[model samples]
Target chain A: MEIEIERNLVMPGDVVPCPTGSMPGYGTYQNEVGEIVSNVMGYPAMYNRLVCVNSLRGCYIGETGNVVIGRISQVGNKRWKVDIGASQEAALQLSSIDLPTGEHRIRSEEDQLHMREYFNHNDLLSAEVQSKSQEGKAINLQTRSSKFGKLKNGMLVVVSPNLVARMRQHFCQLNNEVDIIFGRNGWIWVYYNNTNELEVPLIRRQQIVRISCLLKLMNKALVMISPEKIQQVFERTSDIELEDLLAESTLERIKDIDAVE
Target chain B: MTEEILFYGFRQDGRRPGELRQIKIKLGVVDNSSGSALFQIGHTSVLAFIHGPKQTKHEKESGHIHCYFNTAYFSSSGERRKFSKGDKKSNEFEANVRTMFESVVLMENNPHSDIDIHVLVLADDGSVECAAINAITLSLIHAGVPLKDFLVSCSSGFYSGMPLIDLTYSESTSFQVISEYRVAVLGKSLQIAYLNYDDIGGHKLTPEVVREITAMAIEGCKQVHFIMKQELQNACSN
Candidate 1:
């Protein structure tokens, strides 16, 4: 018997169980009987557990609390307006800038933050969505952390915004080293081939296969270039040098592909 | 690659005088876009996405059909550069695309609507515009946009006194043995979208060279149309 998720059970970065009993969540793996919660759909609500489930969610959209990559469209009074793959522009206030506390005290429109000093038009940036409004058109953003800031000197690749959510759910764990931003409006900003930042958690390889499976399903709904293609593209075009491990992995994939044929 | 031989009766990439690069096309990759397709010939990879058939955003005329063709060219380093908003290159491309598409698209079906085509070149080894047209046609078909016929394009250059099928970046940028043509063929009739020549100043290409290149491009155009047809059949059936 197969079980289907009536709702979204997990976000991208979440860890689930493996049925083989060797991986995380295997201890609590439920096979025969399960309880469904109101907000949730399936069983084994633990830090790490295995349960058969289905995900029936609407089309992925960008939202606050999500880290996104955007292009600075304009600079204005103490704030920067960015096109975060959203229908409406998101505002990044000067106050949201994470400057050292001891270095600066007083804040003024021109004195605290000069528009050109931070980001210029057409500059790609990595930021976090801070908030949204009643109309749902307006968005606030922040770049206070070291990880969040202008993405200078990098190649920015944008894909269909709808794929952003799916990509983001499995972010930072791709076999290929890269940084990605899942914009709400189905736009994905990928900084190709960033080896320094791509720390493949043990969980990532597991999720990658899952992503591949979902992508296969999506391929039926619409004609698509698979995630593997995108990953290959990043590896091919990335500015970073291919480490030995990465090169070996690529060779393995190439061999596997050839072997299948 | 060295030692250009004139009247050699052989072209680079092992083609007999006049031949075209192999073409592979897949339509409707991006769902949100009404129409989309990926075109590949050799190492050149281009993706074209078509949106619209909606009401015209530009207020030219109430029922006049509008077609916008925007192209993104990616360099060898993988850096992408777009044409200016209303620059000369864009104006020329837009005019050619408008004219070429208007000829085939049944604009009268939806007089007041618009069709916007965005061609994104993931890798531009050479013949960017020609590949773009092939991809766009498939995308439009996938989007179910009504059309009178397929508008196809291909590039040819005079190299070693022999017409090359599709010039690679090195060959295109080198301007060696150079009389290039951007020929658009629709069934029996042919239209020249843009033509450029280098090195041979004030001298017209020989009639033989022109004929050979035109025939090669038209043949390639037919292949492109075939691919577009199959892609449409697949998309519709699915």
Candidate 2:
């Protein structure tokens, strides 16, 4: 878009070149003299009367109801501390998760003892941010939804959080071969669609690996990833061998692809 | 007033009293880290990076910062010597860096987070502290950390009855240059974030000398800021 070309770039602490009357918005703060200043390195754009800085890169800060994928780092008393690519570990309380039978029951001491059976250390899982503590220190996440739970037999591809654009649906099924979850926290998971199979089929596994590699390439080039962009890339690189796609020469070519188009 | 310190109004290295050395910088050098920068001024090279806003042992109201500053064995201009972390001078410099950035960084924005800072002085001609500060500031910007303004620094020395800006290793350690001032200022605001005065020869601390040297150092900071701004713009364009 022409508008993107005009977006004024600002580094941390730079004064936004906006009008004096504009209100400070996300990634920006008003100084004592009342001028809007950027708090991060990025372009400053106006959302109505509020001037906000669209940061190009930073740690993930999840809001309420946002779906995120994280690794369980610590199994504590009745809670699992998840490293969700945020500044702090997100808390997955025992009460926030549903049992396998989908029954809502009060947590007994037995459940606390069996917490490891549910989610152990270093286990990756998907959950929704439920709420935050008053100080915003403790991030509470819930895995009550049917699709939100432990992830196994999958490949995880991590990109910068900013590269994944917010979409109406983050989950996509590609050609009935693989399932992709574009976690808002930049953790992309490509797993087999068939849950019953303990081992992934060779074809599906190849597709999963290819998809993850493409995602990494897009992220390295600072391109925003969306379902449409993924389809285009799959079409473009279909002929190249999967191992050769990540070569330095191919990466250079891919970086300049937009210009050729 | 030593004749050898400055030969006919030009220093040994052939730089004017007001001139700074050539600076080269590259951002995001350490891809694994959240943010990293390699900053070189003259022969002084420092690599600075930050990791976290991640897990911490204890919780706090705002982001907690930890700084690690070290110098390589071959960093010094003279005979190579290991500048271990326990060295008094390096320890003091680390504390000064952390305290200076505490106010500049908007820590409250990332409450209950831990920010780790690591800086290694690969080569030290002079003004290693100033170089470290500038490197950290650039990497912080690369990481998109919140800050009131860019924290830039410069070292100035009072010698030969004149103020010398951006001192080199020989100029800084010369017996004739009795006192040196290292100042870090906030970009645009022109406020001093850090001021370090070293009296190597037991020189008396005078108000006039302080004012003059700090003024020269602040001017140096502005020049440093100009160069850093250009680097940032180039990174964005790419």
* TM-score of decoy 2: 0.92
Residues B73-192, candidate 2: write the lDDT tens digits: 878897888556878887898888778888888887776777889999999898988999999999998887888889999999887677889888877777778556899999988998
RMSD, candidate 1, Å: 17.4
lDDT, candidate 2, A49-96, per-residue tens: 778888877889787888889999999999998989888889999999
Which segments of candidate 1 are over 4 A away from where they belong? Answer: A1-261, B1-12, B58-60, B63-73, B76-87, B188-203, B231-238
CAPRI-style docking class of model 2 based on DockQ? medium
Instruction: Please give the lDDT score at residue A185 for candidate 2.
Output: 90
> Compared with the true structure, what per-residue lDDT tens digits does model 1 show for residues B74-160?
444244565534667556776777777776665654454567777666677777778877777667655555444456777777665
The number of the candidate with the highest lDDT is: 2
lDDT of 2: 0.85
TM-score for the A chain of candidate 2: 0.90
**Can you give the lDDT of residue B38 in candidate 2?**
96
lDDT of 1 by residue, A139-184 (tens): 7888777777766423444443433443435235355544444445
